[model samples]
Target: MTPVLSRRALNRATLARQMLLERKDISVLDAVSHLVGMQAQTPHTWYLGLASRLSGFEPSQASTLLENGDLVRVVLMRGTIHLVSPSDAAGLRPLVQPILDRDLQNNTMHSKPLKGVDLARLADMGRRLLAEKALTAKQLGAELETHFPDSSPASLAYGVRNLLPLMQVPPRGLWGRSGPIAHSVLSASGSLSLDEMVLRYLAAFGPASVMDAQKWCGLTRLGEVFSRLRPDLVVFQDESGRELFDLPEAPRPSEEVPAPPRFLYDFDNVALSHADRSRVLTKEFYEQVRPRKNFAPQVVLVDGFSAAEWDVEDEVLSVRAYGKLSRADRAAVKSEAEVVLGVYGVRKVVFV
Candidate 1:
């Protein structure tokens, strides 16, 4: 049997998957496939994910992508809405549809108002309106109220998000900006197919297990389709003995691979890997995930484990290591972090 990847080896591989090894010139769509997809929060960390990678990525660009119909904002991977290219969404949405539907059925936010409703008509109407022009969730809710006046706008909005394949108009997701998320109809969106999308996912994030796909995408049984094409793929297993799969030509560097410091966007695939995330994060780092007044934590990497919470404020990026690091590793982190100071053309990267 092939040996399991040691934690350090896994860290480098994770960095490679996440584009931390070296920046590539790929477009947003290609980058999206790599690392699977970015973790999304409305108008916030989502853009940071795109910003941290895309060299010229601007706060307005994410919105522009959405406005031009190149991207879609919808709940995906881990059941949170992400801003992804329409082509990826087309293929991925179908894969996660059941999980999303099941969640809606179980959640009171949508279940209550959508109960006994002709959901098909509602979805169609919502789709048509979005296709006509961009509208905020509130605006869409107002329109839905015109049809179902008895339903609360709040409830109808949740139901529409739960029912229709909606994409937010651009500017909503552009970096450094935040506001209402507008909607577009996925059916009206011309993008890639399910087969192509599944291929993209495998190409970018594979050597991964089925559960990793599910955890990253909030979908499962993609391997059902993948199993049919098993001949076209190479496979491996983790230390826990769970099966893993990857492409034949993909990179699988040897353990003890040297890695530099990486600044991760919150909830990016790097952090989300593994059912047990000890490969990238330890028990202590997980505790820090608890929010301090809704502020997103600035996570730092030491060796492989998440060693501290950090921040970029006052034109300075601070590294607060939770534990001590070896001198060489500390220098490595400091050197890499110093470049992040150049992100906005600043010269200050402070360590706490």
Candidate 2:
């Protein structure tokens, strides 16, 4: 009989892999690589995601890497920007190119204007333009327009962005600094085969169903990839009988392990990575903290599940619980919030 993993067990496994169970003492590059890169569409707040998962993490640790080109923010999984090592920036982009291709073909805004345009020629032009220096989307678009006069300049730029691997360069993602979005062509080199990527996914966010991996990467038919890797993977059934695949040696700690309070950033991958998020985010919590007008609220996790929503304003951290928390749980939450406040130099924490 296949072993059954209760939701709590699955939650613990995920927390362990994500470095949320305990802060890991590791370099920012290693942490970023180990977790397979962070979902980092937002500019500054994503630093909070790292702060929650790494010991003694300073924003400068990652910011310095970004400025030095050891790390980058690029469109990868699900066609969203991710903060990744330069290697992954090159490797994962090719594997996920289909997602961008599909978007370019079907995108409601940019597809029509790009019809009949020579995408290969446009990609060549983009590469040539970027070869000189990084250029903002607006600047790149204007330059591409001079060659392809029939296409909308915005659509031409959007097409090239989807067609090629581009990295959003520094001063843009740096902490406490800001700049207009700019792009440079990412150097193409080594790439990850589907087999290797599937294994990496299981290592990072696993004991998961095929759909979960699909959800995380925005790729389809991974059921075949999972099928091929099943021989080496340890299989388990979720409470609902969904088949979950994980690396044989991957951490699957007992459900009884203690989970400390964690404050997740608004776009943290933990909340967004899985097809069924019940392991960490309950439907009730989702209903209470659901985004308003597409604005996702950063959440507080207590006992390894989403328990509250939090934000900082005017140097004050404020938390609003979805339901009542025990006195101890409330204290733990406050203590964790204080740590976050201290990292950002905020002075106070308040419960709302």
The candidate maximizing lDDT is 2
For model 2, the superposed segments whose C-alpha errors exceed 4 Å read: 289-291
Query: How do the residues 199-285 of candidate 1 rate in per-residue lDDT, one tens digit apiece?
Result: 566666656777766666666666686676678877666777777766778776665666556666665666764555666777887
> Where is model 2 poorest over a 10-residue stretch in terms of lDDT?
284-293
| C-alpha RMSD of each candidate structure in angstroms | 3.1, 1.1
> What number of clashing residue pairs does each candidate have, in the order they appear?
9, 0
Best by TM-score: 2
lDDT of each: 0.67, 0.91
lDDT of 1 at 110: 66
lDDT of 2 by residue, 52-83 (tens): 99999999999999999889899999999999
Residue-pair clash count for candidate 1: 9
The TM-scores of all predictions, comma-separated, are 0.85, 0.98
